[model samples]
Target: MADGEPPKPPPRLEESVKQSQLSPQILYSDVVKAHSQPYSQQPFELNTIFDAESSALKEISTYQGKPSVVFPFSDKQVLVEKLKYVLVGKFSHGRPPMDTIKKFFVSLKLKGDCNSTIFDKKHIFIECVCKEDYYHIWLKLKWFIDGYAMRVFKWSPDFSPMKESSIAPVWIRVECLPLYLFDEMSLLSISNSIGRPISVDPRNINRTMLHSSRICVELDVDKPLLDAILISFKDEVSKNILEKFWVKVFYDEVPLFCSFCCHIGHGTGTCKRRLEDIRSGQGKAEILSADKVFDNMPQAENSTNSTKFVAGNCGSKMGKQIRPSMEWQPIGKHVPNARSDLDNKVAPE
Candidate 1:
């Protein structure tokens, strides 16, 4: 029966067309009339949409003039207290992935779990599960991740991404110290005069090295570093008399410290504070003395003498005159009138 007849249309398509034809149509004139009506007489649907948009715009305008809410000090204190075991670290060369950092710390066999997250896009914020883990990670000072050096710093409530830490733990060697003053208490006393003493080096504790005692101390870069310390002690031969000794202090691998700005990471030549002072006619830039400049230069090795020469500061290739080494007095020798004139020595301009 279907062979000679035409096929019928699909039921859904035919029904859809019938339904469309049955629906009422709005003329172009009717649409124009509706839009031409006053806002009060507009259709409910159109009024509702416009009213919602207007309300949103008004809310945004009101917010534009409102002041930002100030963060309470109590809340900040609570937050910082909770993050006591947190540390902030940043690579000097490259920014490694979070997993790479986590795995690297884990490989060290830390006492507790350490979690790391990207901080300020350039730095890494690490949270340790325990205080032991926190000190273990932080006390190392510097870490190498795939040969890239990462500098770790303690996290504080006032930590800023724009500024580098001014306080750093540095290993300082106290040379010319008497052999009798090699104990922990004596070393700590000497170290305290320099900065906040963290710990005495293992070799110093064991008395393996007698030439100098090494100690890790937390130094504030904003303060002037003491190049030498003056110690007064009772004479071994004459207990009633006091004698003075100068202990030479040597800072190892210290970054560029600005004497003008009293900050680390920059030299006096590039000090912004000095530039501002000069520009404002408040004061002239302070030139570092020869002694201060030489303090920063590496000591040249020599068999005859420990002498330092300034080459470029005088615009001469031959270099300045060699500085003579200080004459160190023997510890046991008693000279009742022996006095320390080392403090009176002045550097030539």
Candidate 2:
């Protein structure tokens, strides 16, 4: 062909096929052998085999399959508007009443405007105008429900089940754990009493750190449970006699792990739970037992056979360290920075 003239259209399909008939073909067995090595033992760089552009395009196309539609908004509207989440599980046999679900979410008065519709027998589509509202509901509902065996998931147009990993246990340093809680089982019992999944960290198992008043604990419980435990301990150490047995509970303000999923480099706000909430809702959370610390108490190894008591006058102010009435406030509100010296306090008869 002349330089100025465009080459004629490629030969007909039949001619091209005939000309390339002798080309060698890669056998399926050869392809299989090429990739037979374990992924870890593979010699080639893993990234080399991955086609980034093609893979990205494939994902984009998959997402585009059932793209979300944005409804037209009024000109006066100033907000970005609402998004929906799909809650799924083996639900009741028929469609759940929409009014009841809507009323339930609204009663919570979560951060957003909430609405619900029966997506199907097994799925409920919940919509919240505010992202915060959408999240709060997911976190609270993921763990337990009154009587329903169901899970909360993000509403996906493609209707695929959301895939999410469970939140992992977080390691937290607990300060002023009572010195009396010496054994692992005792500590575990007390830890479990807070109505959450917790354990004495294995690192503290063999090490003799109970000599110090602080220890590390790993928790898989929800945030509310942790707060409740803190509040409970606060109440315990307020009274004079009870205070002698309990220590002020203090949690590490700066944690190495994510407060949400208990992973590093993140906080509860940016946790995997939220990520899962925005994608597919997480799986069923493990339910914690209602047992409290004192309920299933670990027996003391050594016991005193006999006890001697020194009686004191009921109205005697002889050995009391009288503090100002203002200092007698609730433990939850006012806590001393240092442990109080209860040795000087008057002993009850």
Candidate 3:
């Protein structure tokens, strides 16, 4: 049985499972290969995008049956450096100052440093800045743009894929892009000027886009009007006529009585001027005033005192006069003010 020959060991699993560089997988394969190799060793070129002068983008795009998503970028050297940093590394320090970025670039101007936008995201209908010659830069940064798109929106950027903006997530549309993107010059001038320049990538929406165009992004919002609509939408009995009621008839800058009574007519019985008017025969008042003239006011009846004081129930002493209030009973059944009047009448002066 010819068993003398030594059998070769099984091939290394490392070689068997080794990944590939290209099968026309487009940006995905590029990232797979780039990440497969150490980030420290992968070209790390910040200047020119990979294969800027080749039709490789078209071939790879066709191989995957996807179109190239164009991204517009600014000519500002600051954006170029920032974009370079994003391409070569992650966005550290979050949002840094444009001046600081520009200052850095001005200090260390790199050779052939072309400005590229981080549209790292694209959707169906192929979002882009409607800027002049945007297509030029778009074709240049095709790989990075598509890679960013995959990393951001969680799906490949597709023009006329399946759904339109009318079908996208509400938070993705209203809050994210137009509202946030309109404010960032990085997106406004470089990315498309749609309602929300801020966009979720078709591939991965987590990776944020650093640059966009302001021309198409309509970020302006009528906040007051929008709030009004929301308020109306949240309409309830709270906004009803009786009182713009909060928890228990809450009051504002206006006086408590005035606010409750709509600030126009008479207030609570605590009104002092109304009491005087009732005494002067201007109107027949129902609620008796604390300062009313009492028949039991023999004490201060002829006395030359404009008013005398009488202690009330809760330390809130009321003004004493010839007239007595019938509406409010004293703390005790007996009238304390009456007793005071009796004592005052008996005393001289």
lDDT per prediction?
A: 0.65, 0.41, 0.28
- What TM-score would every model get versus the actual structure? 0.50, 0.25, 0.12
How many clashes would you count in candidate 1?
0
Error of 2 at 139 (Å): 22
Worst 10 residues of 1 by lDDT: 300-309
Tell me how far the alpha carbon of residue 82 in candidate 2 is from the true structure, in angstroms, after superposition: 41
lDDT of 1 by residue, 1-349 (tens): 3798988766898888888899967799999999999979986754444555453332132346884555557776887888988888977678767778778988989888888888766688999989778777777777899777887887777788766666777788887666677789889887886677878988877888877789987775444454555555456877742444455567876666665554456766677876677678765434434235534433311113232323222233322222334333222222222234334332232
Weakest 10 consecutive residues of candidate 3 by summed lDDT: 223-232
**Alpha-carbon RMSD, candidate 3:** 32.5
Report backbone clashes per prediction: 0, 3, 41
Order by TM-score, highest first: 1, 2, 3
TM accuracy, model 2: 0.25
lDDT of 3: 0.28
The parts of candidate 1 lying over 4 Å away from their true place are: 1-85, 92-94, 129-136, 139-142, 146-149, 232-245, 257-349
Winning candidate number (lDDT) = 1
